[model samples]
Target: MSSIYLVLDMQNDLVHAGGPNGKSPLGEQVVARDVVNKTARAIAKARDAGVPVAFVRVGFSPDYRECPKGSAVFSGAPAAGIFKLGAWGTEIHPALGKREEDALITKHRVSPFYATDLEVLLRTLGVKRIYCSGVASQAVVQATVRDAHDRDFDVVVLEDCCAGPSAEEHRNSMQSIARFCRTESSEAMRFETLI
Candidate 1:
């Protein structure tokens, strides 16, 4: 199957220890998991196997015009000043080793496919399967896996490369995600076999 590695929401705000929201409870989980190193290994493996790499970052405009006002999940983003475009918090974590050739899809919401160029890019690359890894398993990872399944694309979640607000939350989300996609550790993912 033609495939792409989708690195979802590994932004500094969500993963970096020194980022704007770095000290938040949610961010601590990411740091503890060493998500950046794990995700970087996954990306390197994908590149070695010739699978395209796509990055999905969640960021709203500086004015927060795209942030939903009524949604509890996003209402505080504007005030907290996290995920604002052009800000360091919105940039991908440096340890992921992003290259210029990787495709970038920026979103203002939880799901990368929602109101984003993800689908178009996937279609353009003729991707039949998506190998996903990122921070916050209960949120972006869960959302993307479900959406990809509904969209008829094969989904694979790199369990070790994903994190959540807590270890329990990550485990629970992985269990739920297994119903929609294959879940495996980064070490077990053999991209050559996938192709």
Candidate 2:
């Protein structure tokens, strides 16, 4: 397929009701935006359309060696005990229904393409376009769009499937991202047409 649907960081720690972020403000925004449900539906539609789906997560080792020490983004992960690999926190949210044949991408950083198998997987799949959806619109969503744009891939951000810390942040991030790639709501995305 020339187009692959990339679902970034819909992990338990980030989106599930009982995970670490579940009780925080991010969780409130997620619920308010209904991003988790929309993203799950989009994932199903993509698979039914015969489009490959890649689920991307950001996690680190038990000791947090892979986590950046100085960056404001991830430095607190160690202290907070979140985003650990191979744990319930890092697992794809159950409602999303991850299939065995689907690509499972574990990323140590925010950008899925940064030093990860995502690029190689995209190349192997002959993917020329990417459909993206995920949590924290200001982070993974924006990062993937910009990186994929520079790499010459036609990228589409499924806006309703992405949530940020606040409504304002999500709106601003989506506005900025619109400059580089396309943005569509999950309901408006027609994977069958892309495939």
lDDT of 2 at 24: 85
| Residue pairs that clash (backbone atoms under 3 angstroms), model 1 | none
Over 1-195, each residue of candidate 2 has an lDDT whose tens digit, in order, gives 999999999999999999989978889999998888898899888888888898999999999999999989999999989999878999999999998998999888889999899999998888998999898899999999999999999998999898898899999999998988998888878884344
Cα deviation at 8, candidate 1, in Å, is 0.7
TM-score result, candidate 2:
0.97
Please estimate how well model 2 matches the true structure, expressed as its whole-model Cα lDDT: 0.90
- lDDT of all predictions, in order shown? 0.88, 0.90
Which candidate wins on TM-score?
Answer: 2
